[model samples]
Target: VGVCVIPIRYIGRKMLARARVVQSSQGDLSSTLQENFSSQRDIRAFELEQQQIRLFRDRIRRYIQASIGAVRWQSLLTPLIEFVSAIAMAATLLVGNMNGMNMGDFAALATAMYLCYEPVKKLGAVHNKAETLNAGLERINHVLNAPDDVPEPENPRSPAAWKGEVEFRNVCFGYQQDSPVMRNIDLRIPSGQVVALVGPSGAGKTTFINLLCRFYDVLSGSVKVDGIDVREMSKKELLSHIALVSQYPVLFRGSVADNIRIGRPDASDAEVEEAGRMSAVDSFINETGEGYSRMIGEMGEGLSGGQRQRVSLARAFLKNAPILVLDEATASLDMKSEEQIQKEIERLASGRTTFIIAHRFSTIRMADRILVLEKGRVVADGTHEELMASSPLYRELYNKQQMVAEEEGGAPC
Candidate 1:
């Protein structure tokens, strides 16, 4: 019986190690499938059908191999235990005969050994199950036990007055510690001001807004809303005062009205419809005949890009926050739609602090002030006319865009 247990224990260890590999390979295969599913359009457009198919096949093969390896060890455990038990029984019978034991004595001893063998076999099966379960739990715990990079404040503070004034004092930040994306940024945006951020790609325009929103903390200096440092305020309270409409907005599976009402959960049906109307969402909803009750698929599927942009704008309108951030809010719209939404955006920006991040000079024309960034620093801060005359970098960017618009037979900025 003791000799029988040795092989089971050794094989159990091998099963445990291989089980981890199987779990990891299974996760990798699942992630690849999800990525391919979500990016079907890109896959077709890039003509990568064969490549993706091959990659998926390789992952499947790896997953199968890992599974087989784990099973090999597990399957060996039961058979090896049974084989050892047979040898143990044979050895007991031979020893009993050599010792001149009576048949009754030998039978009793054999019965006890058989009962013990049954439990040992059952325990070996249980051990195999336990190792497989442990592998999955380890993966889950890896995520659950990960450290939070953005920790909450020990004592959160709220502003006595919620003004729209935003200030960045010598702010510096980077996704990586040694390589800074934005450096020595200092600016103050007063309430009711409309500021446009423009630059060539890789400039710090998005990073500036990210820091102000506290999506990431600045490595140096501070961002202040009203008179309080944003780090001192709770994330929820700070975000409540700002409305952001990104280039690509995410909409969940729900009715159009339900998606819009996410801006203000307590908003009435009338208020939601009003917001939809303000953002020109009502026009298309009416065309569909379902109006506000029209269902939106996951990630705003089954809706055109322009319609998704309008829905996102509707949310911002419903929120009516004091601070508005539009990151290429109208980029997805056609000329006619852009014209209509531009008017709505102007109305929404009235008496609110607005920050617009756009590459289109037409979009930035309405901005009271424009800040041009180069590399990681603000290179120019002035109106359109002032920038064109004084800042060569800004002049070159605007002129290039203007020339492209002319070549494309679009209206000049």
Candidate 2:
């Protein structure tokens, strides 16, 4: 009995290892399928259907090959165990024949051995199932054991009537400590001022806002709101006072009204419409097949870029928080759409401490103050006109955008 179980256990362990690889391949295949389905518009626009099909087919083949590897090991186990049992049965029969045992005794012993064989086979099959399940469970356990990047403090404090004053005091941060993204950033922004952060792509403009929102805490100095370090406040309580409109707004499968109400779930329908109207979304919502109740496809795929930005703006307006941050809110809009959305953004930012991350000369000109970052450090800080006169980099960036605007047959910002 012990000898028979040995080979079965050995095969089970080997199958378990292979099962993990099969599971990994399946995960990759599933994620790719979902991404392709969600971005079908982009795929069609780029005319990459043949390329996408080829990639998907290759992914499926790899998954099949991995599954077959695990299955091969599983198939070998039962046959091997049965062969071992046959050898044992033959030995027992020969011994019984040499001792001249009675026919009845031999028959009884043979019947018992045959019956045990069925249970042994079933046990081997159960081991195969256990191996597969254990591989899955191991993945789940790994995720469960992972720690958060910014964990909540054991004792947290909520702000008392925060007046929306934001300050970055000698702050420095990086996703990787060795490769710093923002360095020695010190700024004092008064309440209700609109500040624009402008720089080249790697200047850490996005990371700056991300740190302000406590998405990632600073490595050295501190970010403060109303003179209180953000780290000292509860994340939820801290973020409740601020509203952000990101470069790529996220919208799930839901009605337009539902998506807007995500900012404040308990807000009344009238409030949602009021926000939509304020953000220039109400005009277009009426044109949709279902109006405010229109069902959005995954990632809001059915909506145009401007339409999606309007929805995102409506959500931000709905929040009506004291602080607003726009990460290139109008970057992808058309000239007319950009002008309209810019108007809506002004309304949303009114009376709120606002931050803008932009490259458009038109957008940066509206900022009360502009901070020019270079290689993760602030190189210049002043109004647009002041920077144009004093900072060569800022002047060059403005000139580039002005040329682009002129080439597009648009007025210089």
Candidate 3:
């Protein structure tokens, strides 16, 4: 064991480093694969398949080089350990004879030495396993050792209730310091008001909601909930006041009942059913003969787009949080489904401070207040009619959207 230990520690340091490199390369390659697959349609439409393939092949080659380097070091350790064990055994026999050991004593020492070989062999086997598994270990340790970008307070306060009045005070942020996502933004929404955020693709609409949820610490300024700084509140407190229905509703692998119950774990069967009914999914659930027993695949893969959206809405209904945020919530649905959800969305927004981030003019037209953003600034704030009269950007976006609607032959909302 001693003979094996010395070589494994000293000779294996470089091997561990190589193993980590291999793991990181594999991770990078996997991430690239996921991105490429998710955007395959865009790549094909843009005729960039060859470009993507070239990049992917380059990543794969790097992964191959890293794997070979790691394996080479691990393979070297096993032979070196065997050579040291053989020498140690020979030295032990010679020393025993020179020290004048009797035959019986020599035989006993010989038996002990043989027993030592078993553990040393096992240790060598363990070393090989460790060398390969270190690749996985490095992946785990990277996440574990990473510094938290958003950390909880040492002593966190969970508010019992929030009035849902949101305030953004001189707020600013950037994923990179040189390019700000939101800039010196100041806004206030009264409790229970329905607000719509309209902006060009990169005008920080999503970033606003992220800051509101305290997903990242602001580089400067503060976002408040009911006059309390969101950063000061615990995660539970921050989540309790908001019920979110995103553009793509992500569901876990569970019975339909289990998924709906996630919003309020203590909800009874009747409560879950009522929430589903309100969200317009109860009829379909009962028709499938599964009622609440139906199991959904990951990300609700088996369900229709409308069904998934309603499930998320059902979750919000059950939670009954004071703040409702629907980020492109019904954008993927068909006209029929969109209309159904729009009614549900209105019901969901009633008497709650609701914020929506859909680009469709029809969906946001009824909002009590609309904030038009451009280049990280709120360029206009008003009711839809007021915005149409006041903001050229809003008018241009609305006219383009109306033309598209006309071409699609759908009546104006």
Q: If scored against the real structure, what TM-score would every candidate get?
A: 0.94, 0.91, 0.80
Residue pairs clashing in model 2 are: none
Clashes of 1: 0
Ranking of candidates on TM-score, top first: 1, 2, 3
Identify the runs in model 2 with alpha carbons over 4 angstroms from their true place. Answer: 40-50, 341-344, 406-412
- Candidate models: Cα lDDT each: 0.90, 0.88, 0.84
Q: Please, what are the lDDT tens digits per residue for candidate 1 over residues 54-129?
A: 9999999999999999888888887888888888889999999999999999999989988998888888888888
Query: Which candidate number would show the highest TM-score if scored against the true structure?
Result: 1
Better lDDT candidate (1, 3):
1
Checking candidate 1 for backbone clashes, the offending pairs are none
Per residue, candidate 2 scores C-alpha lDDT tens digits across 228-340 of: 88888889988888899898899889899999998889999999998888777878878755678988987887898888988888888899889999898878777777777
Cα error, candidate 3, residue 221 (Å): 0.7
Backbone clash count for every predicted candidate, in the order shown: 0, 0, 0
